[model samples]
Target: MLRTITIGSCVSVQGLLVGQMADGKVMVRVDEKTYVGYPIPSKRAA
Candidate 1:
């Protein structure tokens, strides 16, 4: 199933994947909350 995930902190999801930083976790933001996850990124944009 596909879903609409939000940008956690300021990490780049479509351009950059700078590995954990100040926002040391990948997460899903919805309704003012964050949920950590190991995003299985399919492909990146140009």
Candidate 2:
């Protein structure tokens, strides 16, 4: 699955879902590199 995460405050990344950390951060791989950040909340339709 693909997920989007925020790096700092303004930086955001979207890539393949790697794994989730115990600190509430998630990891994602864009190409050959992987990044860990806070996952963005998905919007739900009501």
Candidate 3:
């Protein structure tokens, strides 16, 4: 599934859901890189 995550107060990233971290963060892949950041709940989930 595709998800969005916030890396900072103003930075947000959108990509395919990779995996979840134990610290509550989620991993996302935009192209070839994977980023781990705090997840922002999607509208469907909220």
Candidate 4:
């Protein structure tokens, strides 16, 4: 299934999680970004 996986505010309007990188950093396509220290859920499955 395809679900919207967002990094809260760590991404931008032009950013995208284009698969994961080798170092675990999500390959995002963006110019600048904003970071928000929010609690991210570990799992969203119910």
Tell me how far the alpha carbon of residue 8 in candidate 3 is from the true structure, in angstroms, after superposition.
1.4
Tell me which residue pairs clash in candidate 2. Answer: none
Sequence-dependent TM-score of model 4: 0.27
Candidates ranked by lDDT, best first?
Answer: 2, 3, 1, 4
What TM-scores do the predictions have? 0.32, 0.96, 0.84, 0.27
Cα RMSD to the true fold for all candidates: 10.0, 0.4, 2.1, 6.9
Error of 1 at 10 (Å): 26
lDDT (C-alpha, whole model) for all candidates: 0.43, 0.99, 0.90, 0.39
lDDT of 3 by residue, 1-46 (tens): 9888999888999999999989899999999999889988756554
What does candidate 1's lDDT look like per residue over 1-46, in tens digits?
2323235545433323334435444544445554554455557698
lDDT of 4 by residue, 1-46 (tens): 1123345655323344445546444444444643222222348578
Q: Where does candidate 1 stray beyond 4 Å?
A: 1-25, 43-46
Estimate candidate 2's alpha-carbon lDDT, on a 0 to 1 scale. Answer: 0.99
Output the better candidate (1/3) by TM-score: 3
Which candidate gets the maximum lDDT versus the true structure?
Answer: 2
Candidate 4: stretches off by over 4 Å:
1-14, 31-46
For candidate 3, the 10 contiguous residues with the lowest summed lDDT are 37-46
